[model samples]
Target: MYVAVKGGETAIARSWDLLAAARRGDESVPELTLAQIRQQMRLAVARVMQEGSLYDEELAALALKQAAGDSMEAIFLLRAFRTTLPRFASSLPLDTAAMRVRRRVSGTFKDVPGGQILGPTADYTQRLLDFSLAEPSVPAQPARAAAPLPDALPCVLEVLDREGLIEADLPPAGDPDPVDLTREPLMFPAGRPARLQNLARGDEGWLLGLAYSTQRGYAESHPFAGEIRMGEVSVFVCPEELGFEIDIGEITLTECQMINQFGGSKRAPPQFTRGYGLSFGEAERKAMAMALVDRSLRAEELGEAAHAPAQQAEFALCHSDNVEASGFVQHLKLPHYVDFQAELSLIRALRAQNPQEPTHD
Candidate 1:
């Protein structure tokens, strides 16, 4: 005799109230404003925007606040809200070459055209917590250089390409429409565009793990960070009525170019292969991880052995979404009384039939 639980509606309503109260916390502390989150917690806002596939900083800030500072929840909220918005026009492929770079670095070369600019990084900062930040105050700023950084810096990969050290970057014959993962199911043997799209919104920790696995002898990739540039890029959209591309806005972006050593194959000669990653804002870790995973997923194309989990496109793309992962993992809390009862009955009947031997205490 199975009895269904009632009062679900009332319970859910109360749960919402509880959640609201918890989110608000103590009234003594000042409530966090959306503007403060947008300005101060800019990195968090950037991550939500990037993963949520929405460029609105204000909306991302609101989502972060509503999510109680949980980035995954913020991303989910932003994504859900994005689905309700009407699509106007698709943007043209971004031009990274013309980016107004604020930070740029290369691991392969000693000196690049415009010397490496280590802008606003905590890499060299000590791990110790600063107690002074509890009562925050404006700090003196360093004087800026009179001249601005070069608008366009030469790509490190291009320098190698000139020396015939890397494979030539040739575009496909015709510009084809990219598969929209949001609307369509991600099929295996995915093209670069589809894989990149999936990786861009993929969970950071998961991607980081996969990337780390590759470095730990999972894959044989002699990879070098060719270039990593962080700055602003203009977004353009072509409306059907206008029949001309229009600059919609500018977005902060991080672009990584990874060069991997490739042995000569039957079809192609020995050359350095390329892996690319581009994301919204200054997400160097995510971008770098994406690049590593990108290269690993290209094993088939490069005629290399696909032995690692990261090398499998089906595994990588399918398990990347945090929203899906959270849902599946959390669903264990759901009632399974019927199934458990059946298992319990089966186990008891089997025990009665086959008298188990008593263990010596």
Candidate 2:
């Protein structure tokens, strides 16, 4: 009789040690510092912080290094670490109007009041391989005075309201208490608009691929990024007892507004609708994709065809979490002997019962 497997504990411990060593790399080489990861791999850190739903740049940088530049894995690592963090006072809703923007652009208008700041972007960078900088040297940069911050532009809607173009004249109500998704299981018809807040804080590569698939006619492709803004948004928390808002902190965010022109259906008049995307860092592509996906998800609301995969709220929202998707996909590597054995036994029994079954055919 075969004995049950034993002494697996020691093997498991050894395997863990090996994994740790591999992650750390050689002892002779200088250890990868968090600062190095933060400065050099800024995009990775930004992604981690965005998807991880935490705004700590330093921690995000460390997670990126630990995950070896795997944005999804780094997000998971950061999120897992975030769970252990102490619960501080929840901040109030951020006022995007008060956002001290580093960069802001509007596709709708070429020239706005404050003018445009292109900032750092790879939009025009050629994909050619650069072999010149084998050894990097810092060049002295010119010092310049800090640019003056622009005052918030009155909401574009306000302009329409003044001209009697809009039916409503009320100022935009600030986002009320936002809900946290990590603490709860995603329920059916999930309404956490705050939870879907990632268009601001999501992984750029992942979002870009999803957006590309749509453009390739895999999903709804008709979309235009109305505006993409990157800047700081202030967070405030007002306790019930305090009865007043208190400033918490500021976080860098990328916000995208997508416009989809919809024709009037039998039921409603044609109107310009909005889809919003927001994230924690310079994630314009992600935010734009998110806005498109968001509008696509509003097929029901817009009284449009809801047959497309992008139009399915359940599928899109449920599968959107990169951590959940990555975990389930990767978990297949774990031992599955018991399930495999069951399938094998069933197959053998079926085969034995049908001896004349055409094996070759």
Candidate 3:
């Protein structure tokens, strides 16, 4: 019973009807198909996959439709569905170096191992609204090269890595398994892997704000975009019985590697530290934001100061999940009649104790 309201079920059913009506808009207008959302509204689908911790484009698109395009609601729906799925064996480490390059760019150097490919980017385009797109028109298609690109293109960071200018990514001793954050609660004093996992599944707007803070000098930050690569990488999973890896399929990914200056200490030499971010699709902004935040959170491990909220692992990871945050914040909408009444009585008593002054009239 919602606050002892009568016929709550009827109200709820009516509410659902209203939601559906609104979602459909005009009945004459064609309803958006799942394929349309998956292909046309790709970024929305990507965000739902990233934050929901699920990688199914179809499901993400469905969730978006069910939620009527409310991203937070869509994420909640996707996660709810994901909870019912059975887990298979963990996949092998993704070989990003072997990714089929679609878009690759680096800010650190003029040229990288493979020449920068500005593939299907709107970054250089004017921000003016194109009224022409409002009408149905034939879309333009890009020309393909005579020859196919190499199967494997060297990572842009390799240029810096060769000279030992950037820090090496040495695996921790014993090579422990990374934390499955979805299964385990994020405890305080979380490790790099845990932080990375949280950030990967974190809310984009929240991460973006924190990442922007680092750039604005909220933390000791002079980060450079070493590379941003968007491509399709093969996913391999090894079955315990098979005893060998099998390529399941390919998924589009956007990877960002940020290089930041770090002063040398007694135990280490001066070199550029790395901040890494990976997204499920061509989510360049999200990937870049994740990398910046990843670096800031490494402040303690790198023997630097944690002067910002993003640097604090507990704060960062706890609030990263928009689902949880939204729940807590939105719960206020629920009936709180008793609590409100109690507060009302107390406030009345307090006001009675401190009577108002006599009016001049």
Off by over 4 Å in 1: 1-7, 139-143, 358-361
Q: Per-residue lDDT of 1-361 in model 3, one digit per residue for the tens? A: 0122344898989988998999999989999999999999999999999999999999999999989999989999998889999987788999998999988999988877868788867999999999998998787797785467788889888777889988887786898998888899888888889899999989999999999999998887999999999999999999999999999999999999999999977877999999999999879999999999999999988899898988888887888899989888777788878999999999999989999987896
Per-model CA lDDT versus the true structure: 0.88, 0.69, 0.90
Off by over 4 Å in 2: 1-7, 142-179, 192-209, 216-221, 239-243, 265-268, 356-361
- Name the candidate that leads on lDDT: 3
Q: Model 1 over residues 1-361: C-alpha lDDT tens digits?
A: 1223445898979988999999999979999999999988988998898889888899999999999999988998998889899987889988898998888899999888888888878888998998988897897697675578887887777888888889877777895888998788788779999999999989888888998998888988778999999999999999999999999889999999889999979978898998888888889998999999999999989888999999999998899988788767765667878999999999999999999898998
Give the CA lDDT, 0 to 100, for residue 151 in model 1. Answer: 75
Clashes of each: 0, 8, 0
* Comparing 1 and 3 on TM-score, the stronger one: 3
Q: Which residues of candidate 3, in runs, are more than 4 Å off?
A: 1-7, 358-361
Q: On lDDT, who's better, 2 or 3?
A: 3
Q: Compute the lDDT for candidate 2.
A: 0.69
Candidate 2, 1-361: lDDT as tens digits: 1113345898979988887788888889788899988777777677788788888999998887777677777888888888899986777556776778777777765666666667677876897777765666677695542776665643433343365433342335884554566676656664537436533444455556656666677655566655677888878888889899887777888887766667767865665566678877777777787877776766776677777666676766666777777777776766778999999999999889977746573
- Please give the ranking of all candidate structures by TM-score, highest first, separated by commas: 3, 1, 2
Q: Pick the candidate with the highest TM-score.
A: 3
Residue 102 in candidate 3, Cα distance off native in Å: 0.3
